[model samples]
Target: MTTAPASGFQTRRIVESAAACSGAVVAGLSLMVPLDPRMMGNTSALEVSLTVLNAPRSAAAGAMLAVVAAVYAMIFGARVAWCASFVAASVLLICAIAISGPVSSGSLAIVNFIECVTAGILVGALAAATLRRPGVGTAYTVGILCGIVIGDQLQMPEAGAAMSRWRWLYAAAPPLWLSVLAVVLLGVGLYWHRDQAPIVSESTVISNVPLVPILAGALMLTVVTTTSEWTARYDFGAAGLVCEILVLAGAALVAALLLPGQDGTLILLATATASAGSAVVAVPHPRWSWSLTLAALALGFLAGRLRPAPLVAAGLTTALAVYAVLTCGIAHTYLLLPVIGCTATAFVLGYAFGAAVPHTVSGMVLGIVILVAPCMIVALRGHENGTVGYSPNWYRDPNGTEGLLPPIVAVAVTLGCTLGILLLRQLRPVTAGHIRRLPGRALGGKFA
Candidate 1:
């Protein structure tokens, strides 16, 4: 019932504008600076160039840094935001300095540590600032960072010294740092704001849907399918099945906590459909590619109609489709039968459980289940065949092939399946309760 104070709102607006500006500047600089060419030549030269590039990336990083700063500012005022910014900057600087030696000259080399640290600090600051600025969200910060990382990846060469160095850094340092920084920033902000009342909270009387279960189920389906392919020889089916059951149970438990009249079964159903679509892709069947494409389209359509729950499911399914496409080329013929079967099984299990659980809890439970299942399978299977196989000019010179087409096919099938699903769901009428109920809300609810 309580609203944000006038001062809080005004400060949030100011910080939001600053955060947007910072993000724009950072995005521009990230594209302009060439990380690869600058880090060329001798190690000394590389170090110098990296330090020089640091200034621009640092400025860009300011958007995220401001987000964190704003979070502190909102809870403890401007002084706290400033202090947090200073601390964040110092921490990043120290991390960069410590890791610089490896990138320059060392037996156990450190790759993009300098660039990542510098960028990370700026991002952290922006994130803090954005969080502090009440109405301002973290969208700009996330968008800029994703763009920089993707751009860096796309621009990097696949072969030679530069590429080798880039890959080493990409695999080891920057990602780890970013992950750590994200966790730290989120944790700190949450801790500081724990006592503060939320600006918005959904009521049980509105409709009791389990957001967690739906997400968990969808994630579980993805992981299980991915793991089954990654560890084809493993027998983790029982464990995966158990996880699905747990997700459904959790959803049911959450539903029990809501108001008596609440109903989120439709949401659970929608999530299940999307999760199933994603699982089909993971299975890697040639036909599954088409299935995945269809599923993605269907989920997307349902998401638009269902609001929050379906949207989440659609996003997850879309991710699955993307992963499938990237891993598998356009040809679905290369996908293996076993991979497809496993993926399908996982999807079916997730869908069944997701549909059975309470709407209130389904999303979170499903997400957790999806996330954990494949990881467990992978761990149980061990990593004997984890090596990356290279194929020289696969399209241009098929004679110089290295790996089998099964994996590739698996990827393709998933993509196709996702697209197909989406298309079908989108074209279907609103009266078709199957797609409409998928995200838990009635057709004429908020979506109408």
Candidate 2:
């Protein structure tokens, strides 16, 4: 028996994906500067805000821009597409700065949105490209989500308290400081990743992968994530932390134990357990958020070593959607359901998407759109209906969220049904052994 050359191992693309994933995480985390104020229904005391640059809108813009960049990656591959995104983002930033300043103006806000959107687009493209690797999709997922956990952790401190505590960082143009850091991180990621050379040469096309399940998984993730954000908004202490730690650790252990084998089955089990655990523990925890993120990173590292499959992505996504629907429907009756269910859903969704859709730019965008649409609706609707997030202002004025259940049910129901139907036609993987025979299926079956 002859062994492959040492160059084979050296050619691993996981590091590149992981690095890009880190940049995406920072982008998500650092974006807090511009997006937070927009969501809070207040103007940024820091800069001239845009007319339409609220939190939800900004996020939507980022998602859309990223989708576009991903499309480009689909056509031109990562190298050309990312370079284009960099050029485009730079131009947008210059334009944003030219119009932004002390005086708040709609045009300035628009410019700012454009700039951030550009960053988001590149991040999305990079994420999708990274997913194209054999075992790196999960790592990228870990980095991006972990970034969110870190940012949220930092954000937990009250503005005044945070400002006072991190005085030097927050004092003179905190947003600027954060933005620069984001840009630097992104640049470093792009440079470090440069290109997924080996993966590209070895694998290029996604084959026999059902689009519906991919989309379903993406949409399922969106619902879970949105709900998670809201659920995590509340608090849970020591017990929650311990639980989160265990779940995250368990997720990684499970992934390491089973991957690059039964691609879909691994994700199915992984997503179910992860979400179930997170929901049980709850989110928005003060100390445990970072710990949870650390756990996710571990999951990513382990999962990245394995391949992902569509059947499992779809099943897991369907199950999560069902779970979310069930949880949201009964949240009124069972108080703990929302916190446990949504948080669990979010964690699982994050892992599932990272594992399932990392390499498919189009699939990633579809999932992102599914994820962002509800937030956009709620954010925009909040302006009109006086609802916060989706279900209303439980934090401030509980009465405002009274009619919220209907909308929540509506969104959840709509997503669940669509994905459930999509699942019917998707080919199911019977065993993990298929992963060994059809490893290229993880690449979406496109062989060049």
Candidate 3:
């Protein structure tokens, strides 16, 4: 039998997948600068602490703009939107470097806000462009996760120190300039292959984006983010009840606006819980955590390729792994437990999210929000309020043992929610007319 030549459609898919993966890597690397704790916490002056530390708040504002950017990409075209976003982000980074020494902390914070907003637009565009194509979508997701890890590694003090005089090439980080150059080249390549469009189902396309719902979702994210940051920074008279209420209300609003029906609800809850649980297993030991994370990501990628069914299975496993990691012992003292727990959490959550990603604009927004929300909420609570697990107490040598109660409760609650949703779906009688016709299924893949 003769091997058939690849069709034009297959070629298009290949090109688009490569472009999407490249764009996602750049976006992830760009995003890390704003999200970096060292960058956020390190300030020029002692008195201007508040502005610098509140970078996450600016990131939240950026998330709001991300919604607008995603809509713009859908309306105009992903290529145009992505190029514009890349230029904007570049300008902001350049401006940030120019003003690093002379500008006030407040001005620096503003720069951070704009940079984050531009980066968010880039990310939103990439997601909107690729999420409709199965192969491209998987590539984008995996590329982003890997890029985040690589970016973090590159920003480490040792990596910067190795650069010596070359380190001064960029104000933020030595490799950042290289990342920008790579993005520019990638954009040029994308423009060159602009006509090579991937096969996308007509049903997945959003002719007229839902403005009201999108705006509502953006507002909710903004409020939740702002409230979370404020609550984290300063103690309210009574544990910031109003702020907590706002955060919860905002999350609920997002679910209402972005996630519509039963399936949507299931996706939202499952993703959020898994994300929160996965945040806990931060292997504090120097280089081990990074290596373990990469290995876990690789494992997850393989698992995702297998396309596990009943998507919640992976998420539930992730929660259980996290609980086990925490309850085992101090991660530093009992290295085996953390290694196992962290690997399990990353592998399972990776599979859960990678396989279950929906193929709609609203679903795209939900994915981005799920990634951001858990980190924000955990940051809001901090190690003091409770251990959502990401924020370790020790600055230099974190043991990863303190504050176990909260994460245990969180994972347990998530597990309960998953079971409850499954029970509800099974018990409730289905009617054809009662079902809402969403753009795509909650879980995307053979199982969905």
lDDT of candidate 2 over 358-404, digit per residue (tens):
22344444443333322322332233333324222212121232233
Question: TM-score for all predictions?
Answer: 0.33, 0.54, 0.70
- Tell me the number of clashing residue pairs for each predicted model: 104, 18, 0
Q: Please, what are the lDDT tens digits per residue for candidate 1 over residues 1-448?
A: 3356877766546544444334422432232232333233334643444443232223223323222223223334323433444454345435434444434343112233333334434443443344323234224322342333223112222235434444433432223344344434434443444564422233432343223322333333443344333343344454543553344334432332231122333323333333333222232233234344334333433333335343344334444434443433432345463244334333432333332222221222222222212222222212233311111110111122222233333333333333433433354322433331223232112211
Candidate 3 vs. true structure, TM-score: 0.70
lDDT (CA) per prediction? 0.33, 0.41, 0.50
The candidate with the higher TM-score, 1 or 2, is 2
Superposed by TM-score, candidate 1 places the C-alpha of residue 18 at a distance from the truth, in angstroms, of 5.3
lDDT of 3 by residue, 1-448 (tens): 2334457567667766666666665565555444333343355543234433554555565566666666656555555544654565465457545544555546655665666676667676666566655777677677666554444333223323344464444335324564555466546545754674333334664544456436545655655555555545565643454445435534543454344344344344444443354434444434446567667876775665466443365355546646644553555566565556555655655665554443355555544544443343354335363322134321212433445544543454355445544544454433576532224442222111
Off by over 4 Å in 1: 1-78, 103-128, 132-141, 144-157, 161-327, 331-448
> How many backbone clashes are present in model 3?
0
Error of 3 at 100 (Å): 8.4
Highest-TM-score candidate: 3
Model 3 clash pairs are none
Please report the TM-score between candidate 1 and the true structure. 0.33
